[model samples]
Target: MIAFPDEAAGCPLTGIVASYTPRLAALAAEPGFVAAVDQHAAEIRERLFAQGPELMPRPLRRAELTDYALGFLDALAEVGWDQPVGYDYAVDRLTAICWLVHQNGLLDA
Candidate 1:
């Protein structure tokens, strides 16, 4: 099994979410920020769940999340994406994914 950072401590995923806290806080003054995050979370959830004729939410194996996260980071690197000093959609999406992973206890798997 791939080892993930300890969630209780300072996981990189958690840190990523925390790093954007200020931006999110500032953006909270306007509408749509929370909605955008919720939408991102839904997207991440779809990626993490099995897709088929079933209607229920069947979570894929934990390894899938690891793969998804690594692939995302890889894609960012391939595109020369850098974390901007200001609000960035990529960072927000990643933060949402991290939050989902943490909330779903995928890090422990």
Candidate 2:
């Protein structure tokens, strides 16, 4: 039997994929998803400006902010969450993942 994941266990990306994937598209799509993506991406910009984008081998440029955020949301929308209802939930998870990945560099390799 298929088991739906809880809030924290599943990544935001999973939620994105679940809702938008061809195998399972969201019954209701969220209109605010684009705005949410912009908001999330803006946060990345602020962070990069404040500290630095030296997470990679070489330093990243400030212009990469929008692209990264767009890519991130697009990735989640395209491959992670799949439900319109899960947008906010995905945002919560995205916030954590963003902080972990960018701020703390927890996901940095």
Evaluate model 1: give its lDDT.
0.62
lDDT of 2 by residue, 3-93 (tens): 2233124234333333333312221354365455546545555655556366443344523533444466666656656545455655543
For all candidates, the clash counts are: 0, 16
* Segments of candidate 1 deviating more than 4 angstroms: 1-31
TM-score of each: 0.66, 0.28
The candidate that achieves the highest TM-score relative to the unseen native structure: 1
Q: Clash pairs of candidate 1?
A: none
Estimate the overall C-alpha local distance difference test score of candidate 2.
0.43
User: Candidate 2 has what TM-score?
Assistant: 0.28
Question: Model 1: per-residue lDDT, tens digit, 7-105?
Answer: 334234544445544555544575566677778888877867767787788764556665676677667778888777654677778767666665677
Lowest summed lDDT window (length 10), candidate 1? 1-10
